[model samples]
Target: MTDPMQDPGFLQDPYPTYAAMRSRCPVQPVSTGSGGHISYLVTGYAEARQALGDARLSKDTAAFFAGKESRRRLHPAVAHTMLATDPPQHTRLRKLVTKAFTTGAVAELRPFITQVTDELLDQWPVGEPFDLVARLAVPLPVIVICELLGVPEGDRPDVRRWSAELFAAGKPDVIDTASHSLADYMTGLITAKRLDPGGSLLDRLIAARDGDDHLSEEELVSLAVLLLVAGHETTTNFLGNAALALLQRPAELDHLRKNPDEVPAALDELLRFDSPVSTATFRFTTEAVTLGDTDIPAGVPVLVALGAANRDPERFPSPDLLDVDRDAAAHLSFGHGIHRCVGAPLAKAEAEISLRAVLARFPGIRLATPPDRLDWRRTRLVRGLASLPVLT
Candidate 1:
């Protein structure tokens, strides 16, 4: 078997490697410096879904390590968020977020989302080439998250900069520094919110904290930073990746244009065809668990390949092909069961509105550079282009 990371072809198009892995070794041993030598990387659809939802596979790395000396070596702050925890803590954290994602909640934000999309399109310079990532993908989510989190409009630029630093891919030192910076910033923001409560997610969280004894000041700040960063970064990748998919497949773009009603379905296909999140949030086995034929022992870190599982041919025929009409709702792009993304609905709504607005405004939009020449994020868990150049 080949190292997926070393293969440029695999980096550009991982489905082939995923297909091979799924067939040959659904449960493969993978090594990560943080978790040490571990049997990880679950590829098959059923196995991936089961692993994501399985109670036996603990999301809490701290609890998994307990009194072990190795545990202290890892970054405790990054590994202690909702993404890294199980119920009832996960459940409690998710509840505070779920309110912001209710159907009524998202519907109310639709007009705002549309407005943001239109404003971005209106500002795009015509004729000369521009980086869609800078103009649209990055700004759209940044603005939305700022509004949602009650981050003052003045601080958006700094917030975005901090988020980029925190999520800097593959760079351990940068990640560590960024994590501390974000924590410090959020601590200050939470303090401000406490002094002057405004009607925003932060204010709501502060109010909710007053009622629930479980949510500490530190936890609230940590979760706020998590939501703000994850909320924007993941969706930025989705918008960029979805646009790339449509530009690559003009027919699909045309199909979407003709049937605006297909936006929801197409979004699902876009997610599965080129999922924003390349891998699941890391999970460690609580005990020896058998996935397919491989045996993974306790304390091993596992990454469920959401991207790979979404492209499994056994689940979706011609899985590699982007078919807007395909029933892609079953894809694990938002993940499965307990740890599924809480902001999926909002993310989907934002993507649909943003994509439609971009295509409608810039009908001639296409990749300005060869797809092969496009750079990708190196250290981040997201699978996305570094910049998507386009001629509007």
Candidate 2:
């Protein structure tokens, strides 16, 4: 089973494996490739939902690695992010940046998002196959998130590169290098924001850093790095998976193209079918915990298999089928409880607008290569294709 994860069959189609795993106990230890750490993977819908919000399972990577030289390569800014910490620290950090991603704020960006989608689609080479990942999925979100965060357009290529490298799963040194580089880059930008506070989201964050209720310098840099990376990475992969899902099912793709209004609602089902986030960030057990009737010892890591939970037959009938009309709202793609993804609203808006536009602009779009030939990224956490070549 350990070697199967690296197998091409498992990489292209893990859903069958997930179904087999779920048929056993929903929560059990598996070879999650956590660098020899004995990790438990939660696959049942109820178990995953419970573990996501379980207070006994901590996210404090900083405290866990304290006085231990094992993780010395991890920068402070990358280590202490909201994603890796439990409340009240997670609460304080989430509150400071929550305003920028509120529903109303995301609503205001709809027009801009559509404009960007149209602009990106405008340059498509006529009647030729192009790598959708390179031409559209990757750039659309990079442009939107960069503008939202006030990242200078010139530095975006570097930011994109560093962000991609940050997810190098097994390469510790590469991950360490990217984390430090991004942190140092953000530190300089934050200092500049202090002198000239333009009205970007980063400017607002800087104002909060200096205001009465302040964020520590490390927290500021950490939060900036988190937003810069997750703000678009998740959405980029989501779009790639979504497009692939639709291309495989011509009926479903046409159903939405005829009724574009349904595109927004369909995102939930699309996400459920093939979640971009294969597993939610791992949680460490503060004390002994029981999930899905399985007892786990204290000081162990728990990985919630979001992709499996979303496809649980018990949770959603015929989970393998993508029914756009189904109420797939409960899927764990964006996670659950307090640590749920904060940028979900923005990601959804960006995905819906971009997906709909892609369908409209190129109704004849089809995969240029065989589905089995597509390669998936090597990263363990993010589930996405290496490239999506399509003919327009």
Candidate 3:
């Protein structure tokens, strides 16, 4: 009967609740409060991984709601994106987008990422308290993604605003507004790219060809919208959470400062220690599936709690502790299986550059206010601080 999404305390620090659930009801039913919608929450590491990779669990909302009353509730633009599709559709959409984030492409972006990180740090108010979320975490990814996608600098603020509003839980109207507005903007942007290709990824997507198969107009807009939303938001949260994690553990912070070479490894531990994505997107069972001791009926929605799985004792020793030296590469932060995040490489590069720059710039930086006084975002989909006030 417990609803973690409705509990402010759970939203602030869900680890305790996740630990309790993993030990007690590993696959428990809970309500998300979206028009009385309910879902089975998978908390244990094995169960979560199994559920995520299960082919019986459908990602297409339209397939689940084919003739249901909720069929019309979702816009085509929102429901038909690569994230919401499986198999052939997801394959096609992802193929067009994957090359841009391949190792080579992402490597090319390091210089740009470093330049932007340094530029943002240079603008940071020195010797005075400043909100790291606003000054550093928020702008770095936004700038990088915008530049990568060939989006005009002037339009990024609106994209950021709309993306933030879309993820705001309980604001269905705001979500709807942002969804349609961003879709429209992406549609126009794709059109602009078509007319005058900027040689950016967006242009590549527009020109992508595979054996006479090309992205349809709707697919192009949806893919653009997806990249815009996912590319920046995850990295923004990762950077903010990484900074907060390091700041809270002084010895670990000093260890990392002394061993600057370990920043790359530290990023993996930071991601596992406090995942930015609390849960995977919605998945529904196409047939009865037993997860742990719980029976999940066909057509029932399931959410894989990434935060819980990352800290599950069976998967991680001293699950709650942040050990930068741990071989944390196997963590499920970027997720596992087919739907794993495509832009993870870019996110890691951005975080590594940003974290190193921040530490080097402010060797004596520490939280300006007590840790407990900091505000965490209330949204259930993403875990991040609203503001991280720090002083050097």
Candidate 4:
């Protein structure tokens, strides 16, 4: 009878609710608030992973939204990118876009990421309390993504604003307005890239063709916008979530500082400990799918709660505990299968460099307030602190 998705308590601490749900069944029908829509929520680790990679659970947004009243008002560019399509189109888009996030390409950005992390860390006054989310977490990814995409420095502020508004939970009007604004901005930037190519990734995307198949004008715009949106928010939330978790468990933070080389490996544990992406994006059953003995009808909506799967006791022993040394590489924080996050390498690099730099820069940094008093973001998709006030 509990509305696990929308309840205020679940937003603060969903782990208990997830445990309760998983105790009964991995997949269960739950009312998803208005319009009397019942969605199949996947909470078990094995089942969640199974559901994510199953082609039966389609990612086609138009198909998923049909005959349903959705509060999300997304632009075509925002709604119909690689994240919201099936094979063929999705494969082509993923192939073209994966060029920017290759291993060598992301490795090349470490110096810049470290430099930016240090520069941002330097802004914090010694022995003074400051909001880490605003000062570091939020701006780092925005700046990094903009620099990669050739966005003007002056225009980044507006880009940040628009990107944030895209997640305006209940305000469909605000979400739609932000969606168009961001799409329009990207459209103009793409036109500019065509006229005058630059050294950034955006320039390459504009000119590159995939086996005589270049992105159509719409696909190009959508891909560009997708890169920006995808590159920005998730990393921002991950950074914030990772930092907060480390601060709470000083032992784990010390482990990274002492063994800096292991920071990269330790990132997966942090990602699993407090997953940033609460749930994977919208997916509906293309045909009847059976997950963990639960039978889902064709065309029914399904949700994979990444946060729950990461913390499931079956997949991870002592799931609630934060152990940096644990091999948490298999976590579904970046998703799985063909739809695995294209920017996973870049995101991992960002977290590693940022964590190493920040920990090194501010050794004495600690939370400015009690852990319980910290403000967590009250949204379904992203799980992060609104503002992590810390003292240097």
TM-scores of the candidates are: 0.95, 0.97, 0.97, 0.96
In order, what lDDT does every prediction score? 0.82, 0.89, 0.86, 0.87
lDDT of 2 by residue, 202-275 (tens): 98888888887678888889999999999989999999999999999999999999999999899999999999
How are the candidates ranked when ordered by TM-score, highest leading? 2, 3, 4, 1
Model 1 TM-score? Answer: 0.95
For 1-392, candidate 3 gives per-residue lDDT tens digits of 55776666786689998898788878899876656677899888889888888888889976877777642344578767799898978887887889889879999999999999889888888789999999999999999999999999999999999989878877777888888889989888887776777888788777763235566778877888889889999999999999988899989999988888899988888999899999898789999999988999998999899999999989899999988888888888898888999999999999999898877878999999998888988787789888999998
lDDT of 1 by residue, 1-392 (tens): 33465566766777888888888878797665544544488788888888988888988866766776741222345558888888988888888888898878989999999999898888888888899999989999999988999888888898888778765655667777777777777788888988988999888888877775567876787789888988888899899999999999999998887778778778999999988888887788888898877788887788888899898888889988999989899999899997888889889989989887776767788888999888777642678777899887
Clashes of each: 3, 0, 0, 0
Worst 10 residues of 4 by lDDT: 205-214
Off by over 4 Å in 3: 71-74, 209-211
* Of candidates 3 and 1, the better by TM-score: 3
Consecutive 10-residue window with the lowest summed lDDT within model 2: 1-10
Task: Identify the leading candidate in terms of lDDT.
Answer: 2
Q: List the residue pairs that clash in candidate 4.
A: none
Worst lDDT window (10 residues) for model 3? Answer: 67-76
Q: Which stretches of candidate 2 lie over 4 Å from their true place?
A: 1-4, 32-35
